[model samples]
Target: MRLLLLAVIAALPAAAHADEAAERGEWLARQVCSNCHTISARAPAGRNPRSPPFSAIAARPDVTAGTIATYVRQPHANMPDHGLTARQAQDLAAFILAQKPR
Candidate 1:
């Protein structure tokens, strides 16, 4: 019973942290990426040809959440460097990764 209680206690914090992360990600996506890309279901009209949709990005095998975050922080090529901080990029990546493929 003690072990079970301890496990439950440990899991509670993890669950809370995950929920917090998800919330942060969602907010970041809405604020930062929604302007250029469709970050959510009701994104603003105006698509850029520069990058794929967030859903497509999420489904990409080569680009994991971490990779996306890194790229967003320091973009390459014609992509103008947005200068997103590490935490902002991480949150955006988390939001993008949470999206389901269409």
Candidate 2:
């Protein structure tokens, strides 16, 4: 059983890291993104027609992690630039991607 236990222990860091990223991303979304964007499917009803839901963005064919990272760093006329760091952008991207429709 030692070998099996060692395997599980060794495998945990990556999973934990991903979980941490998703958590940070959710927090960032709630604090910053939620102001204009609906970050979930079951969010406040009657979303603003102008802003698309995060789930929809996540589900889009071209919305990769890199796409999200780039968007967060750049200036958009509508979106408020939170001036997120690379790690923060990565975390948010992971969170958004995680919300993709199964």
Candidate 3:
């Protein structure tokens, strides 16, 4: 029981950190990616036609979270450079992956 309690306590901070990352990622996406891409179901009715929506990007079979993070670090020509830090890139990647369509 003591060990179990310790494990649960240890997990709490990690879970909170994960939630923080998700929130930060969402905020970053709204502030930046929302400019040129649809970030959510009810996002502003605007954005570059050429840019894939986050949901679409998330749904792509070939696109994984790691790849998305890498793209954030080194985007292709059509996508502008956001100059995001590594943490921000990971956060954005998390935000994008969270947008998978049903």
Using all chains and alpha carbons, the TM-scores for the candidates as numbered come to: 0.72, 0.80, 0.79
Q: Which ten residues in a row have the lowest lDDT in candidate 1?
A: 40-49
| Candidates by lDDT, descending order | 2, 3, 1
Candidate 3 Cα errors over 4 Å, as ranges: 1-15
TM-score of 2: 0.80
Candidate with more favorable, higher TM-score: 1 or 3: 3
**Candidate 2, residue 87: how far the Cα is off, in Å:** 1.2
State the TM-score for model 3: 0.79
Which ten contiguous residues of candidate 3 have the minimum total lDDT? 38-47
Candidate models: Cα lDDT each: 0.75, 0.85, 0.84
Top candidate on TM-score is 2
lDDT of 2 by residue, 58-93 (tens): 999989989998998898897777889999999999
Highest lDDT: which candidate? Answer: 2
Off by over 4 Å in 2: 1-11, 45-47
Per-residue lDDT of model 1, residues 24-87, tens digit only: 9788767666667777665664367665678778888898868988988886784567788887
In the range 1-102, model 3's lDDT, one tens digit per residue, is 999999999999987876777779989988888888888887874369988889899999998878988888886788778898989988887778878887
